[model samples]
Target: MTPSAVANLAGASPLPAFAPRPRSRPNSASPGPFGPAPRRLAVAAPPRAFFSSAPYQPPEPEGYSSVREYGLVPMVVETTSRGERAYDIFSRLLKERIVCIHGPIADETASLVVAQLLFLESENPLKPISLYINSPGGVVTAGLAIYDTMQYIRCPVNTICIGQAASMGSLLLAAGARGERRALPNARVMIHQPSGGAQGQATDIAIQAKEILKLRDRLNKIYAKHTGQNIDKIEQCMERDLFMDPEEAREWGLIDEVIENRPASLMPEGLSAVDPPHHGGGAGANGRGRDRDMEEPSAV
Candidate 1:
């Protein structure tokens, strides 16, 4: 009825009241005649089937195994390890003044090559830079980008052909410092006219065609200048894909000689022919490189 009574009723919950817990009395009968009952001994619990785990196993040295997990982290670690090892070798190579161009020439490859060449020249203009080539050749402009840099640098670039130097690759071999182009025994070289596949409107195609002709002529001149061949003869030879072995390449001026024994020059002390002082590396130099001689790292 009053305000306090109304507030108390409003605050109360509508749940039923709980019953208080009942109490139990102790046994009235005491330990009479025997004083107390005999007690039983406690028994222990049996052990569970918790078998021990198998012994630790190491990862495979080489590839992988189906029994084990091969996750992204392991794969990434492997790749990074390989890359680091390769880079160590490359740094060793740069220190030794050796470079390589061993893939299809392209803008990316050419850019790296140019940078290496320039850097090498700056490192020591007197020390020669070796440009090893094993490519099938690619973009004419890209190839020229390297060739132009080779000429621009003050250092002499000694180019060595390992597997093959086809088309622009062959031209680069010839473009090396006079008397420095050399190929491994059994290595092959190829030469051909500049090739193009222009696709566009008729007028644009015509203009591209003209430019290709100009490139061809310019390349012919470059070959002539480097190989000491007559422009007419070079042009005639370039009419088709002309592949030549080391000996033939040498005779044709694509290379100066075919190497059999390891080069004695630049061979550091205690650097055996069997295990040459070498490590893998990446690109740099005045971009001093074989035109993208941006070729991947050859096995050291």
Candidate 2:
């Protein structure tokens, strides 16, 4: 039987069907099902306000400022992905003619450091660019890419070795602007022949071996030229991993000063000197990984 017919038979009248009423325009101050809707707050000059634990205020039409800049009148400016920190000391150093390479080198990182070098050159060619390095090593081609760009730029790259510059890192430390290459008293430097592993067929392995030899010869010459040593001497020195303390590095023409005399000039401004990269590599952009195997046949 139909529901309506049954209902009429059982009772006096059929039950009315539910029909929802169309809601008209909501009131500006109506208490909603979830309590009163929060009014859009307008932050004034001095009276600071907090609503929920989320967005500081509605994004302004002009721009947005980061929470990092809460010291002064918050200028709401949109943030960017250029670098992680808004007011990190490293970010500040980048602005002040300082570029740091504190880990293993790679194409993307080398590209960024190269771009920073170029941009700083465009800003002021005569000013010196400080390059703080604390790295183990990385792909030969990547390091060379940065090395070539450093030479191409007009501004001098004043390299400073903080902890250790090894393999390709040591090459960069030596290639910095002459006389300005300096290292902390206890910093270490190392240079060794490029090492790599080859996969694939026997013929391919042979080809890779030949290329490694050529790379070794070329690297020897580069070291000799920069260190003022003969090619033979450099080749012999690099046959095994040659380690050097700052003093010994100076004697080997790797760095100009051991930084023993200058206590006050350790940092440029009042900012404290940055700590060097720790022993085991971390997730920092530059210290990600060691890709020495890919350095076998470095690209031109």
Instruction: Choose the strongest candidate by TM-score.
Output: 1
Model 2: residues with Cα > 4 Å off, grouped in runs: 1-85, 261-300
lDDT of all predictions, in order shown? 0.70, 0.73
Task: State the TM-score for model 1.
Answer: 0.61
Error of 2 at 19 (Å): 60
267, model 2: CA deviation in Å?
6.7
Model 2: lDDT equals 0.73
The alpha-carbon lDDT assigned to residue 263 of candidate 2 equals: 29
lDDT of 1: 0.70
Q: What would the per-residue lDDT of candidate 1 be over residues 1-300, giving only the tens digit for each residue?
A: 999999999999899789989887534454647675555678645322211011113333786432233232111111343473334444556656887686666666788789988998998988788898988787777788899999889998888998988887888899988777888888888888765554546776677778768778888998888878899999899898888999988888788877754464434334533341234432222222111221233433
Using all chains and alpha carbons, the TM-scores for the candidates as numbered come to 0.61, 0.60
